[model samples]
Target: MPIKESRMTQSQNVQLLAVKAQQALMAALRSGQLRDGQFLSMSQLVTMLGLPLSAVREAVKHASSLGLLVTMPKRGIQVMEARPETIRDCLDFRMVLDQEGARRRIANDDLTGLGALRDRHQAFREAALRGETGNTPDGPIEVDLSLHDFLAAGLGNAQLAAAYAANRMRTAIIQNARPFLQDRIISAMEEHLAIMDALERHDADAATGAIRLHYTQTLRWWGVT
Candidate 1:
């Protein structure tokens, strides 16, 4: 029984190790430590992740399946470009779900989550004011993906939450491109503040209008329209 338990524990450890390796790889790719076209050889992955080659292989396979990485035959793995179509799809889905969430929150008078969103927007504004790099702490794009995530969570919709989380990489891609438009970033910050203000007043119509305008303006800025 003790031996069997030890084997189970070892299996769990391996699983944990693989998960950590995958996360590390994702972080590296997202942060630009791993460029899109650069090949990630097994030896490199093993070295960077401090894992066995087999484990790195497994992790790469998993990440590739998630569209974060692509394995080239006889060339190893490379980071996948978060294409424009992927970005549009992610934003389109978010637009629909977030609009519905806004409507529901307003109807139900649920403003509890609005405060947190406001806070995050304020942080982003402050960061932009300081001319801080747009990448996340780990170097991925630092857009306000968290705000949408917070909204989905507050709406208590598991499917929406899962979908949002799954599309994080694509959203990060759009954010990565945002720094090129410094003026637009400033405008977006003000827009977010306005949205928060409307929500605070429990003005459903105004809130919805503000959000719709914000998204429309974003699409225009990105030339997505």
Candidate 2:
């Protein structure tokens, strides 16, 4: 290969490794192997991620830039804290995106998939009430995340969508430290239904209001004021 091509290939390989390391970090987080505000050295991170030093270093840089980790001088990396400030910031960012997304979606009159989502939320809530599923059923969470993704896509902006996804992932990791508010699934489902209802009614103001209501409730649920 030419020198430039070789360098490009090496860079690509490093990028791939960095992505893999990031994935491993998320896996560790979801599997309870990692916790919020946990501190560990680069060597330990490499062991945890099972990635090479270079890859881990790149991953750390990327994750840190994404607000997922904090690196200390002469110290190891710290997982994102689950403090009130962190939760507030993450949710606030999401609230902005969601409000704008909802407005755009309402303006475009694009609410075709909302019915199914509302139905799913209802079903999940009903199941939770009946004690058929556990407190935090995976179905509702999937539907909830998908609903947000739907709203974000309505913006029709790839960059905004990407930012939303990144922020959402960070919030998810933070929530892992707290888990879904115990027994709050029903209210969350109801809130989602309200938002969908407003959308179906073509009430942009109501939709935005519902979104804000949900955000306030969520901040409360997270004990973030």
Candidate 3:
């Protein structure tokens, strides 16, 4: 699941620090060790993670970049809430970003890398079809985000890919907030399959329609459409 962030090819030391720090922070948050409104400084994080200041600095920097930890001058680093507004804005951005991605993939006839991702995508779809079982922490929702990340990465644009990866947890937060929404889960599975089918057929028109359907379905899941 290292493909969860930082392109598989050029994984950096800081990226590894980021992953560990983020995981630790998440574990702390879920366990109520990190409260909703609490703030911590770099030194505290160093102590919390039992690491040196340099390591904690990079780790904290990475978490801040992903909006997980917000650094305020007087308050230090605050655990940022994944608010509904955050999900809405992230989803809004994704609809634009990922739809353009789909367009580019179709325009360039770049279905090559995507084929390699099909097996994982199918696993993601099945995870969606079944909410809790056969899975990781967030189950199907986590797989769905990974699938989206894969599709975004296949666009061959590093900056866009990074942005998509950063916004992914927002999507997961939204879905995890309602993990048992069976109808939305099934709709997501269907839209994912439709998009995959269109990509396999190399049908630009169908792909476009399917991508639109996917985003529109996303809005419906958000209760916005």
lDDT of each: 0.68, 0.81, 0.65
Local accuracy of candidate 2 as per-residue lDDT tens digits, 21-129: 8888767765446788899999999987888999888778877888888999898889888889988998888888988989999888888788887778888878767
Top TM-score hit: 2
Q: Residue-wise lDDT of candidate 1 within 1-225, one digit each (tens)?
A: 699999999999889888888888777765666654466677877898787776688888987776767888887777666455655676777766666777777677777766766776677677667777454343213445555654565566777666666566645545554444445666777777777787678787887788778778777776776
lDDT order of candidates, top first: 2, 1, 3
- The alpha-carbon deviation from the true structure for residue 125 of candidate 3, after best TM-score superposition, in angstroms, is 5.3
Report RMSD for candidate 2: 2.4
lDDT leader: 2
Alpha-carbon RMSD, each predicted model: 3.4, 2.4, 8.3
In candidate 2, stretches whose alpha carbon ends up further than 4 angstroms from where it belongs are: 1-11, 30-32, 135-140
Model 3 residue runs over 4 Å out of place are 1-48, 73-76, 113-137, 169-180
lDDT of 1 at 89: 70
Worst 10 residues of 2 by lDDT: 132-141
- In candidate 1, position 60 carries an lDDT of 88
Clash number by candidate, in order: 0, 0, 0
Give TM per candidate.
0.78, 0.88, 0.66
